[model samples]
Target chain A: MGDIEITELRKLTEFIKQEFDYDFKNYAMSSFRRRIQRVLDLYKMDSVDELIRLLAKQEFFFEEFISEVTVNVTEMFRDPTFWRVLREHIIPNILLNHNKISIWHAGCSSGEEIISMMIMLDEMGVADKAKIVATDVDKAIIERAKKATYPLKNMEVNRKNYLRYQGKYTLERYYKESGSEAIINPSLLENVSYRKHDLVQGSVFSKFDLVLCRNVMIYFNQTLQNDVLHKLHESLFKYGYLVIGSKESLIWCDIAHKFIVVNNEEKIYKKIKD
Target chain B: MPKFELSTKYKAIVIGGSAGSFQPITQILAALPKEFPVPLFLCLHRLKHVRHGFVEALSIKSNKDVIEPADKESIRKDKVYLAPANYHMALELGHFISLSTEELINNSRPSIDITFESAAYAYRDKVIGILLSGANKDGAAGMEAIHAKNGMTIVQDPSKSVINAMPNAALARTKVDYILSVEEIIEFLLELDKKYRI
Candidate 1:
């Protein structure tokens, strides 16, 4: 926790950025320090230079380290009220304006949430009309999401949350239990695709009707948040919905004005037409 | 069909803290009924990136529902939504909980302020926002917003709080409607449920 450590870590991070083409330039200082300390602890190396030297030799080490640092904390039906807002407000808007919808569940940690979205659409009778592009920075989570199984301990809340989202049928019906894991219904993922996407790089595609980039922006600094929001703004269709984590606000982002708050409380935004 | 009506269906209790919040929170929650109809949202900030079974542990301490909030899930009447570590928990309209990793206010995700502020905005007069013992000013602005929205607000009396900075800071910012011990907060909630039920 010293200035010397901070300086060394910054230099090392910059070195990685230049050589690896992966940017750690914009993460918060505290988080960066914590991750560096963990890396040091993991390798039993005393200095940042040593860790960086090892990382230079092992390319896979860098990938694994990034995954360790950026692993997300998420669950199915995360913000019940946010989902309700989507269902009551955003879903209707999508149904009315967009004939077909493509949603990007950006930073979809383990795909449970993307499955949740599909379930909601199924309940709304719009499952066939929607296609989701689920992306995450971590390969492990993507693999897990692809498998679509979660501990049964988490089911009660997930089911309760489904009810709270106002699903008409029992949430229990969607999944079959395999040992302790609840294997998600394959039908829910029929129209979805999962890939690796880092928000810092910005996205190549556009014209998405809804882009759900929740809880992922907190990893970035304000400048990065703005950058990511701008990317989201450009990618969304006119009148498309942009949903962020509940605590996130576009007020400070550079493109804040481009979207109107659909439900300010839920942090739901609707892209305003030019 | 005299439907449940006091203000809105989003009626519920929300509790928040940073450090040293787990026990007081469990104590307060354990006193509630098995079928407590109001949803309970808890924002207990802990060590970063650690999911240490806080919800499982606390659920054992209380009969009412408890679990981590999932993306796009709905808020239930009696369940407790514990902020997953490293994320901010907020109330979206229509009683769903939204989790975020947005810029950390007061340097914490699952921030007490963000959770209380969003609940206040969505639930208005129907919310009961409580700030428990902690080490920072995270929940102060949020509790203030809740009060301004005509929601009921409560804080553990700092004198009795294990970590007094959070409750003390909240009391300094807003005229909290109740400044009680953890036990009293539970009593107040139970009383309100009975008095206001349709």
Candidate 2:
């Protein structure tokens, strides 16, 4: 086909799944097209067929392609209001119910979600009683997340968000500046376990008391969104909480009846069914 | 019952505005028929951190329901879908809403360019794009994108806008199909609605 990118999207995705063993067939067509366009522009390829030919020839390029495919533009305390609610109400309830809380940062990009959680828990003096799992499909991103270092330009928004969350100390107190980079405190990740699990194909590794899969589902089509919701539902214990993106919801998903809304605006839900 | 004799019907009407277009937008929504045939997608600049009141305010004057669509939400005709704050909303291939937090384009999260370009991409010539008043040049390239795809482009009259930068920017680069004042724009939209086939 002449314009395979738009017309034969399914063919490209199927080829990728069969060749690379990653399931991108279920990704939302718009965002997938955008990301694929980025990859094409970067490599100066003519079309999806040309890109596929190169991918088949160079096995070493998949890792690099994975980085470009996944969007990693996340921030610490991206939504301060959501963080405040989680810190003030949700975590306290979980703490009251159990001595320890297990949190799964599903689709955690570059460790900001994990770091933000640690800071929130630290502020509440409950850091010791928490276990966190951070996962992404890309191992390279996971490695960068583990390092917890971010460039200074990214910090402007991060710092602004943290202040809005009403932290006890300045965000700068947590990271030291070094040549245009801010190195986050590694101690924040002491209880966090990072994994390179694909949300699309990887099995549910374990259940959690709380699962945060914010903004990740935006890239998936409705069919895959429903499938992932069921998977996430199974990965939560009864009465456990699920927090999604501000715009995405558990309300409109297949498992809507299984969960009760805890905070609608923040998109936090409590799983009531097993 | 096709209203117009066009070979292909327009699928969507995407309007982008920044600062001063809200009044015109309010008038447009308040004046459209309850069951307008074409879908209306609006991308307006609003506060990123504050998301509670904008939709409510828009809904107050709107004859039809004004919604801040969720990610992956279905696109239906007549309903006014506003790009929710802090997310870039795109019109997908199958008339679905695609929301993303990709890096800000033109210093806006709900960037007008993204939504307008998406409309042009999905609908091609079956799209109508409108650019309204603002201080920034965000929607200029979007109107250009629509023009490139053979989709119709409309710009608010620069002299009638609250601020002229946005519409004037579009006028400067592209040959827009219409440059109408607020009253004429409302009249034109009503005419389009009448001519649209459900």
User: lDDT winner among the candidates?
Assistant: 2
Give each model's whole-structure lDDT. Answer: 0.77, 0.88
* Root-mean-square deviation of every model: 14.3, 2.8
DockQ of each: 0.08, 0.78
**Candidate 1 per-residue lDDT over residues B1-198, each given as its tens digit:** 522223334386789876777788888878888777788888888864345577778988798878876644567786888888767677765567655554466978778877887777677777888889899999998889888888887888888889999999988888888788887777776766676565
lDDT of 1 by residue, A161-246 (tens): 77666778887888999998898888778998888877887465756889998767766666777788888888888888888776
For model 2 chain B, where is the 10-residue window of minimal lDDT? B1-10
lDDT of 1 at B60: 87
Native-to-model Cα distance after best TM-score fit, residue B81 in candidate 1, in Å:
20
TM-score for each model: 0.61, 0.94
lDDT of 1: 0.77
For candidate 2, write residues B82-175 as lDDT tens digits.
9998899999887788999887888998999889888888888888899999999998888988998889888999999999999999999888
